[model samples]
Target: MKLPTDHSFFSSIRRLLHTYNLPTAYQLLESPPSKEVWKTKLNSAVDQHTVATWQEDIQEKPSLKYINTDALSVGKTHHLYTYVRPNRIDMLTAETKAKLLTGTYTLLANRAVFNQYAVNEPS
Candidate 1:
């Protein structure tokens, strides 16, 4: 009985939402002589963005503090843009913390945010 071996279906499909790392030599790869400099510069910029994002991810806080990295980096970010306050804060006044947490998450998780971060560069 030669059983079919394609068991990893869901895992492969899930990869669509994952971002893959770009190689270091992407800019230097062989290309047509036309627009070489422009292409190289753009590639370098994109790579730099990726590197910054990677650094931010490595430094992400373990606690529930919210940090925004969109302006800071593009590649390394784990799709955590927008307001990310604590789920529940006991130290602060209830009214203030609740107000801070209420529509902030909703505003952050709007349709646009979902489109932007639902897909992420999975490590």
Candidate 2:
């Protein structure tokens, strides 16, 4: 599947950056990701409610940023497969980290689409 590069898509990326308070700065990795890898990551982010989990992973290890979407722009969906450097999460203060985490949790929890599609929620 080709990647989407429409306004709605970029809008989501922009929102992701804003919510994380991440800078627009990023560096692409040496190699582009393969289809399987891109699909897995994208599926994890959009389908599995794993964006927060991925962000946590990135925050825990700066190196992981290279594989995450730190450098976003308007273009083919394949751009998402490009490894980009993220903000130095390791440098964030504890309070700041907590706030970011909370923001992500809130966003995921409140997403209407997520609620509509999510299953196995605890009563």
Candidate 3:
């Protein structure tokens, strides 16, 4: 569950998507890479595109937002990456806030988003 800060965040995002059996990272790309493309390099470009695209995508979907380690409390973000945002922190029930403190809430909440973007393409 740790993200390597030295590399682009999308590399970690792509890894998490696979580890969680989530969606294809290609959806974040303007033009998906070909089979012959070197993934490490292509992913660097995709990372930039993803952040920009996600920022735009959420503009029209106010109910949803992208949450990343940078937005979390320092203690909670050392090993985190992007996930779908939950309800406002101030409005969370005590029990729900507890889950966020424990990281369980993020894991569970992100599943719905993962499924929403999931692809059936063979690997």
Give the whole-model CA lDDT for all candidates, comma-separated: 0.49, 0.52, 0.57
lDDT of 1 by residue, 64-87 (tens): 234444445443432332344555
Error of 1 at 56 (Å): 0.9
Best by lDDT: 3
For candidate 3, the TM-score is 0.25
Which one wins by lDDT: 1 or 2? 2
Candidate 2 lDDT over residue span 5-123, tens digit each: 65677667776645554433241134556779856655545533445656678789976766535543223444322343444544344435555644544554566555756555678
lDDT of 3: 0.57
Using TM-score as the measure, name the better of candidate 1 and candidate 2. 1
Compose the digit string of candidate 3's lDDT tens values, residues 1-123. Answer: 876574778777877666444446776465665655646555655565566556676666755455552453422433323342465654356556567866678664477576867555458
Candidate maximizing TM-score: 3
Q: List the lowest-lDDT window of 10 residues for candidate 1.
A: 16-25
Off by over 4 Å in 3: 1-37, 65-123
